[model samples]
Target: MAWTWTYETADGRETGRSAEFETRSDAESWVGEAFGELLEQGVDQVRLFDGSDEVYGPMSLHPA
Candidate 1:
């Protein structure tokens, strides 16, 4: 299945999305590495999806 990441704001509004990944791990890793930039671009959270099915979501980009 094609894996992808969806970008969002703190209030659940979709802001953007990443390019399709070949694997879930690749998608997750991309997010982990790019989260800093994403935060700078006003993306507060992210969601992972396998095709149209959501795998997980709303992960905060900000540090706890």
Candidate 2:
């Protein structure tokens, strides 16, 4: 199992997003330390995704 980071942005009617990461802890730390600043500046959302099948589905800190 690996952790992935994802971000979503919609600016002026255009939607864009990205995802990348090798560890869940790394992703969460980045979001808490860096992405939170982006949120203050208008980023849509920063979230973590677990690509493990043991969970049976996408698991997020926030229910998803």
Candidate 3:
């Protein structure tokens, strides 16, 4: 199945998604490289998904 990432604001609003990937690894790598920029752009958290099913996250960019 294809994989992707959905963004969320610090206040908990769901934003848009990144481009889809052929593998989960590709998707996670993209997030690894780009999450810092996403944080600067106001995305506070992110979730990885396989199709519409969430595999994990709502992971905060901030330290807890």
Candidate 4:
């Protein structure tokens, strides 16, 4: 299944997408590498998906 990450703002507005991946691990790894810069650009949360199915998260990028 193709995996992707949706980047969003704190209020749930979608801001962008990560490059598509063939596996979830690659998708998550891409997020790990770029999440800091994404947060700096005002991405407040992220969600992972396999096609239209959400795997998890609207997870906060900010430290709690």
RMSD for each of the candidates: 0.6, 6.3, 1.2, 0.9
User: Best candidate per TM-score, number?
Assistant: 1
Models ranked on TM-score = 1, 4, 3, 2
Pairing residues by index, what is the TM-score of model 2? 0.44
Task: After the best TM-score superposition of candidate 3, give how far the Cα of residue 37 lies from its true spot, in angstroms.
Answer: 0.9
Greater lDDT among 2 and 4 belongs to 4
Worst 10 residues of 4 by lDDT: 27-36
Instruction: Compose the digit string of candidate 4's lDDT tens values, residues 1-64.
Output: 7899899999999999888899998988888888889988999999999998999999888889
Candidate 2's residue-wise lDDT over 1-64, tens digit each? Answer: 5665444454322123335557766766666666555555556654455773322222222323
Tell me the tens digit of each residue's lDDT in model 3 across 27-62. 988998998899888899998999999999888877
Report RMSD for candidate 1.
0.6
Candidate 1 per-residue C-alpha lDDT over 1-64 given as tens digits, one digit per residue, 9 for 90 to 100:
8998899999999999899999988998988899899999999999999999999988989999
The number of clashing residue pairs in each candidate reads: 0, 0, 0, 0
Q: For residue 16, what is the lDDT in candidate 1?
A: 91
Task: Estimate TM-scores for all models.
Answer: 0.95, 0.44, 0.89, 0.91
